[model samples]
Target: MNYLRGEFDLCTGCEACLLVCSNRAAGGYNPRLARLKVFRENENLINRPLVCTQCENPFCMHSCPVSAISRAEKTGVVLIDKEKCISCGSCIKACPDQMIRWDKTGKADKCDLCAGNPLCVQYCVPGALKLVKKREVPGK
Candidate 1:
């Protein structure tokens, strides 16, 4: 499994990742519509990028009433099947990190690792975001 990792110390709160992600994910320029969120904490001393960990136990996947969400075995990226999805917003509420957002079609939208080639990672100039192999991450 490969996952997007972010370094808080390296983040500059510039929202470049948000911009590209929003453009790619939502086909718009709104940061509020981005699946990944950056939180400014510690009195604005640091920026923390909150991305979906693609959890070992995915709440979003479990919460889907119509079984719309599933993990890709090859990449370990959780995906939503729009054809099966009913736009119930259950997955959106089930996500603890607020990583899930609404698509233009009123369906759940989330980080799919950009199908293994993330545009957000490319736009992250501060080196805050990078894709980590499964073995590289602990407790995988």
Candidate 2:
């Protein structure tokens, strides 16, 4: 399965990823609206980027009361069906990483990997964030 990976050592805390991601996801440049988060650790020594892992057993997907959230079979990406969403915020609460959140429309929103070409990865000048594929384990 493909997922976003973050390397703290390579991160410069520039937040370029956040800017582009928010613009793509929310139609704005606000970092607060980004689907991913960068946390400063150890007195600003480390900038740890946190993005949706698109878990094999995603808590966000299971927590949706209306079944608005689902994993795309082809790409293995977790997605939200806006038409079926009820704005209940169950997914938000269920996410351990806090990747899911309320959008301007008051509905659940998360990263969709920019339709397989993540702008965050493209804009990460420090090479902190990357989209990578992992081999699925046998009989997991």
What's the lDDT for candidate 2? 0.89
State the lDDT of candidate 2 residue by residue for 1-140, as single tens digits: 68899999999999999999899889989999999999998999898999898887888888888989887877888899999999988999999999997889898899999888899999998898999996662321
Summarize candidate 1's per-residue lDDT along 1-140 as a digit string, tens digits: 88888899999999998899898888889889887999999799989998887887789999999999988776778899989999999998988798988899888888888888888889998989999876532332
For model 1, the stretches where C-alpha displacement exceeds 4 angstroms are 135-140
lDDT of 2 at 33: 95
Least well predicted 10-residue stretch by lDDT in candidate 1: 131-140
TM-score of each model, in listed order: 0.92, 0.94
In model 2, state the lDDT of residue 34.
98
lDDT of 1: 0.87
Candidate 2 lands at a TM-score of 0.94
Q: Model 2, 53: alpha-carbon shift in Å? A: 1.1
Count steric clashes of candidate 1: 0
Please give the RMSD to the true structure for each candidate, in Å.
Answer: 2.6, 1.8
